[model samples]
Target: MPREVTSFSNALVKQARGLRDKKNRKREGLFLAEGLRILTEARETGVLPQTLFFSDASHRLLKELIDEVEAAGGEAIETSADILHKISGKDNPQTVLGMFPAFDTALDAIDRASAPLWIVAQSLRDPGNIGTILRTGDAVGAGGLILVDDSADPFSVEAVRASMGALFTQKIAQARWEDFVAWLRSGPGQLVGTSLKASADYQDARYEKPAFILVGNEQAGLPAAYEAECDLLVKMPMLGRADSLNAAVATAVMAYEVINQWRRR
Candidate 1:
């Protein structure tokens, strides 16, 4: 029995819960990953968790995962369900929560030569939307995903759930819009922002060079500042009356559209 943490007010529990805030996550440079699958994937990706809290009931279910983590020089802490909920953000708390190191996302890595296909969240606050977009970004093998200006924390349990563990695998570049834009200018790529109206349709846009696809919130599109920075604003052709799609869905359509074009050419 490696030190049981049953109390709700435990320091570690408080710390894990605090990860809900972006500031705390940034200060600690660590994020919470829930569920056995994410934990296993984190281990597979060479990102070992610092601490693992598992409900005793799920010990059997996650034993192999624990062994792998331990074999990889990681910690595995068996915990009670009571303590599990204290740290868990899930409605139906999963068996475990694992903490992993947060790496620095260098803006330099996002240069044109990197086949830069970027998904920028311009004030999109939904974790589900953010997570789905990240999954799409990883699926298309984009240069990176960027979360701008108080976007949802991808590490949140909801976001992680929404990503279906893609957060562990994706190269996410997060920063302010201004900083990201300045870095973008230095990189080799044409900036394309999503819009409801444009001179050219999404299928028609030329995705030449390091292409960045900017996506905005569901209710409102990209900010005026980003609009000024965008070289091209393109929209998906919709004959139906539905005004918009989910932020993530729109992002995927645009990102893969670029990929499709690149593959064809």
Candidate 2:
């Protein structure tokens, strides 16, 4: 049986709550995931949490989840609704939340057997956009996502919630623009970037096998220097007043186009 935790000042609860901040998450090397769907996907994807927390109202409802954690040698604690709300930083918090280790994949570890397509997001600022992109990447069969320097925290609660469980299944890496470019130079894929400066249409651009689609920040797009590193740069059509699409939507269109070409080949 899992232990009950009624106090707001419990050590484990305190630690879990602290992860709401980026610095604390960095210091502890852990992040939080909430709701049954994300938690279930975490287990399914073999990224099991080290600790699980449940409110009294959720204890019975989450018994199977608790049992799975206990079977895997993890700790499960039952706590009050208030503590769960506090930890989640939400008004109406889910019954179950988990503390999971922050994970990373090396750039070289990206599998190329499937002629993988990668999404490189540079200096992104919005957690919601980043999360939506991650989910879209998963939908479009992207091999992984790389976050350039100063990108928003992928482990942020808003980002995690926005991902809708895609966070557990995706391979993620981080690097500076210079380092990423150098790595890409030595890698197998062809680099394709999107920019308003380019004359080529997105659909007309040839998406060679093993392609990496580079997207710029929400407002500024890709810097000129970084734009030079791309093997090809293409522009999306803007028929309306808006000059650009949301980063996630742009990525989805490009990713699916790349795969669409590959499938037809």
Candidate 3:
């Protein structure tokens, strides 16, 4: 039997809710993920949440998940919808909420040859963009997403929600620009950067396998220094008044190009 929690003030509930803030999440080393579909995806990926909270109305819907969590010695708490709302910080929150420990995002953990494509972002500030990039990475069969320098927190509630469960499917890493560059040079990989000022058309570039598609800040784009580090710099055509594509959109376009190139080989 799962424990019942009705009070919003409960210590566990409070701790889970605090994960909505980056500072709190970093302090606790846990992040909140809500919705049965996302939690189910996480479980399917062989990753179980440390703690789970679900409403009585959702007990039947989440029974399998609850059993699995309990089998793994994870905590399962049955709480009210109001309490669920409090934890998610949303009026109409998902019935199921999970607290998962943050993933190990060290650059050293990634294997360059594991996949034919990788997506890298620098100074990305939008959580939604981060989530969208993760979804794109999964879609394009990229190994993972490598966030470079001051990128938004991928574990935030908004980012987790935006990923639509790709958060679990995708491997995520964070590192500084210089460190990422150093690591890439030490491996058999091609660093391709997307930039507005590049003379080469993106479609014309011959993307090699294990390509690292790098995009920069949403507003400033890639720094001159960072752009200088890329082995190949390509520009997406902007037929409209807009000078550049959204960072995530640009990454997806580049990622597909890279995948298509590999497929052609």
Candidate 4:
């Protein structure tokens, strides 16, 4: 039996809605996630939300989820569609919404040798691009994503929604550029960067095990200093008028190239 919340002014609803802001999320140490499918992915990964809200329209669909949350000592609330929309800040919100504590994103938490490939992004600002990169990491069987410098928050609602559930499936880490460089050097890893000035064609590069594919800021591209740090800098061919690919797109291209190279060995 879950509690019922009908008013948008309810304290819990207000708190959940505030999670949409990065400051509030940091203060509360929790983030909001919407939709049954995404919540299911989190549950499957052994993560139960601290709080769950659902409307009558979604009751049947979220019955099991509600039960599981209650069983795990979490709060499950039955709310109205209007309340759901208020919490989610969407015109047509998902039937279900959840508040999950933020994950540990420290660079030291990552095990570098656990997987043969990892995706790294530096100074990326778009939440959508970050989400797409996470999806690509999951697709290419990369261990996780290591966000270097001031990348966008992966836990933001836009990023979470764009991930399409891949967020739960991959590990995420954030580190300063120097700290990340130090950490990678401390372990068994190869740093491969994507750059327009690089002479090596992406397809021709030899991608060693534990390859780290690094992409830079969307517009500024990789800084010369950062490119200089890479063991190998590879460039993708721009056959048309476009000089460069989208940051996330360039990452996906480089990631698959690494995977392909490893597969041939």
lDDT of 2: 0.86
Per-residue CA lDDT of candidate 1, range 1-265, in tens? 3456777777878888787777888899888888877777766666777777787534564776667667767777777776777677556778888877776665555555765576777777888887788778778987567777767777766787777778877777668877887877775778898776666788887887677788886678777777778899887987899978888888888888888888898
List TM-scores for all candidates, in order.
0.87, 0.94, 0.97, 0.97
Instruction: Give stretches of model 2 more than 4 Å off.
Output: 56-61, 112-115
Candidate 3 per-residue C-alpha lDDT over 69-111 given as tens digits, one digit per residue, 9 for 90 to 100: 9899999999999999988999899989999999999999898
Candidate 1 regions exceeding 4 Å error are: 1-3, 56-61, 71-73, 109-112
Candidate 3 overall lDDT versus native: 0.90
Write down the lDDT of every candidate, Cα atoms only: 0.76, 0.86, 0.90, 0.90
* RMSD score of candidate 1 (Å): 2.6
* Residue 152 accuracy (lDDT) in model 1: 72
> What range of 10 consecutive residues in model 2 has the weakest lDDT sum?
55-64
Candidate 3 C-alpha error for residue 11, in Å: 0.5
Residue-level error in angstroms, candidate 2, position 174: 0.4
Candidate 2 residue pairs that clash = none
**CA shift at 91, candidate 2, in angstroms?**
0.9
Q: Point out the higher-scoring one by lDDT: 2 or 4.
A: 4
